[model samples]
Each structure stands twice: as structure tokens, then as C-alpha cells.
Target: MKIFYFTGTGNSLYVAKRIGAEVYSIPQMIKEGRYEFEDEAIGFVFPCYGFGMAKMISNYIKKSKFKSNYFFAIMTYGGKSASGLHNMEEIAAKSGIHFNYTNEIMMVDNFLPAFEMESEIKNKSSDEIEKKIVQIEKDISARKNQLIRKGVASDVLSKYVHKIADNVSKNFAYKQIKVNDSCNGCRVCEQVCPANNISVTKTPEFSHHCEACLSCIHHCPQNAMHLKSEKSKARFINPNIQLKEIINANCQVK
Candidate 1:
């Protein structure tokens, strides 16, 4: 089994690790310019973005070729999964790909423009989340044939919302990432950026091709990265994930 994952704040990476298998980072895969795969079971795990998925994830699905007996996707969300799974199915169908199982897991909402990181971490129930993941593991082990279905109206609405999200990403707060006086040119942001969007010298430089995943901001050791639109000063990275792991999984500099 091979699992491909995309993460910003480690929520999806944590789930990918817990699933247990040869996991691949979608960002790293893109960096290597490799996408073809053959496996008994293949899985995609990533956090939901704007009721859809990261543009990189979407493009990867639309462009890649895969041969597998079973394919699955796990979408980890900080708030609502909404039509994320449905959206994935729609995108996959266009590529003549199908998923055997699909599910969602709620975790800390790291979107700083909306929720406070402290409250999000405090309110999340680890036990409840684990219970859900345990069930998903059992089901996937059995190669269960299940897909999330939604109302036609909502599904249609989601497509529009997804487009809006794409636009939001382009013009979002990170469109012009700011570095504070605290920055010591540690370059942690450059190392953690999945998009290869940051370059470091005395400070960080964003290459406009940003995914707005916020990995750079969340993983920055000095917490010097910030956006004017952000609602709180707090940041988050999944407790189960370490900085080095994130660097290994996402660094495109090398």
C-alpha cells in the first residue's frame, strides 16, 4: 500500500502516519516530477481547503496515472468537511479514477484568519477523533466500497464555492507574506514550504506560486511569519508531528 498526503499544519500528515504504510508526500512527488504508480492499495490523505482541496492536489489528481486494486482518500478538516469528499470524487471521475473508500476527520482548524489556535487545540477531543480513525482503518483494511453522497443542490453549490476558494487562495493573506523583526533569517519557512514558494537570505521571499497551505508559517521556529488578515497571533502544528519530519516530507530546495 502507498499513501500520498498533502499537509499544511501536520493534521493530514498525522493521519497519514497513523494509517501505517509507505507514505509519500504529494509535494515531494511533484518536486521529483513523478506521478505514475502501481500498488495493491493507494490512498490520498490531505486537509480540506475551502470545501475543496489544494490546487496542487487537484492538479495531481487530474494529471497523474494510477493502477491500483483499491484507491482511497481521507480528508482531514478543522471545521466542516462539507462537500470535500464529493468534490474529490468529481475530480477523480474526470480522470477515469475511482475511490473505493472516502472519509473525513476533524482536527484543529489552523486557519488563523478564523479561529484562535489555543481554543481550537483546547476544544478538540482526541478520543473522539481517534475513534473515528480506528473505524476508518478497519474499513480500509477490508477494502470497503463506500463513497460519500450528497444532495444535488449542495454539490452544485460546492463547485461554485470551490472556485471562490481558489480565487481566495490567490488573493489571500499569504499573497504577500510578511516577516517580522523577530526573524533571524533561520530559513525554517523556506525548508517547510511545500510549494517551494519561499527563499531565504536575510529574510524570506515568496515566489507568488503559493499554495497558501501555511506550512511555512505554522512550522516557523521563530513564529516570525504573519499575515495582516490573521485573526490571532497563535499558530499550530500537530503535536504528533515533529519539525524534522515536516522538513523531510516537504523540502523542495534540495
Candidate 2:
């Protein structure tokens, strides 16, 4: 099975790894125009952004072609994973791909401002999150035959919300360059950038097509990238993922 993933803070990557399937980053696949899958089953693993799927995933699915008998999607959300699966299923249907399984796993609440400030105190430990992932995997494997149908109310709400989310994601403004004094000009961000937006000369440069996936921001070795906001301090980084892990985990072929 081939698992295509887009991970922010490693939740989606962790889930994809646990599935023990071949994994590829959606950005890399799009860049290379490669969708050859040796396995019969195809899976998409990504984080739930803005109550739906990430724009990058939607764009990739729309542009790329895949040949697979069975399609599956696994979405990981910090808190409630509302309508994300429904939105993915809708996108698959548009592409004439039928999804055989869909699963949602709830991890730590990492959305900075959505929840209370103290909510970070309740963040699940790495071990706890791993346990939940194990259970989700077991459940998916055991119930592979069942299909969860979306209710009419859910379908309508999901479609409306997804449209709104796409608009918001497209218009969202992000800081152009986030630098700190600790930056050593390692250019690691430039190398890992899927969009190739960042180039290292005197400093990291940003161009258009910045998907705001935070791959550059989060993978900075100097811990220098910062969004221009008071809430930037609240931005949580997963200590479990180091620089090498970020590179290896971000792109995998099981």
C-alpha cells in the first residue's frame, strides 16, 4: 500500500508510519509527477486543517492521477475531527476514486488559539498518543469491511464548511520571513521546502506558493522561524521529531 501524507507536527506522519505502508509526501509526489503504486491499496494521511482537508492535499488530488483498486484516508486532528473525512470522500468521488476505509484519530490539541490557553496542560503525552494510535490501527484493521456512511445533515454541513475553509486558506496571510538571532544560515529550510520557496543566500527567502504547511517554520534547526503574532509563543513544536526524523519521516516509501 502507498500512503501519501502531509504532516505539520508529526501526528499524521506517526499515523502513517504505524500503518506500516509505503509513504510519500504529497508535495514531493506532485513535484515529481509520480503516482505509481505497486500496492493495490492507496491511503492518504494528513492533518485536519480548518475543519477539513489541507489545500495542498486537495490540489494534489485534483492534479494527479492514481491507479489503485482500494483507496483509504486517515486524518489526524488535534481535537475534534469534524467533517474532514467527509470532505476527503467528496474529493475522492470527484476524482472517480472510491474510498474503502476512512478513519479519524484525535491527538493533542495543538491549534494555538482555538482552545483555552490552559488547554495545553491537558495535551496528551507521546506515549498516550501512541496508545491511541495503536487502538485506531487495530480498529481499522478489524473493521475493514464496514463503511461509515455520511448522514444527509453531515454531508450538507461538510460541503458548506469545506467551501468556506478553502476560501479562508487561500486568503490567509502569513509572515514573509521568520528569523531569529539563533539562525546559523544552515539552509536546512531551503532544502526541505516542498515549494522551493525558500532560498538561502544571506538569509532564507520566501516566494509565492507557500502552502503555509509550516514545514520550513517547524523544521528549522536553529528554532528561529516565528510567525508575527503574540500567539506565536504558543505555537507548539513536537520535541519527539528531530531534524533527521523530520526529513526521513516527511518522505517515506513503505
Which candidate wins on lDDT? 1
lDDT of 1 by residue, 1-254 (tens): 99999988788898988888899999888888888998999999988888888898989888898889899999998876778888888888897779999999989988887788889989999999999889989999989999887678778888888888887685453465678899999888888888787888898877767777888888778889888778778888898998898998889997
Residue 31 C-alpha lDDT in model 2: 64
Whole-model Cα lDDT of every candidate shown, in order: 0.86, 0.67
Superposition TM-score, candidate 1 onto the true structure: 0.96
Error of 1 at 148 (Å): 1.3
Score candidate 1 by lDDT.
0.86
lDDT of 2 by residue, 181-240 (tens): 888888877765555557677677776555455666656767787665424444455555
- Compared with the true structure, the alpha-carbon lDDT of candidate 2 equals 0.67
The numbered model that scores best in TM-score is 1
Extract clashing residue pairs from model 2.
22-254, 23-252
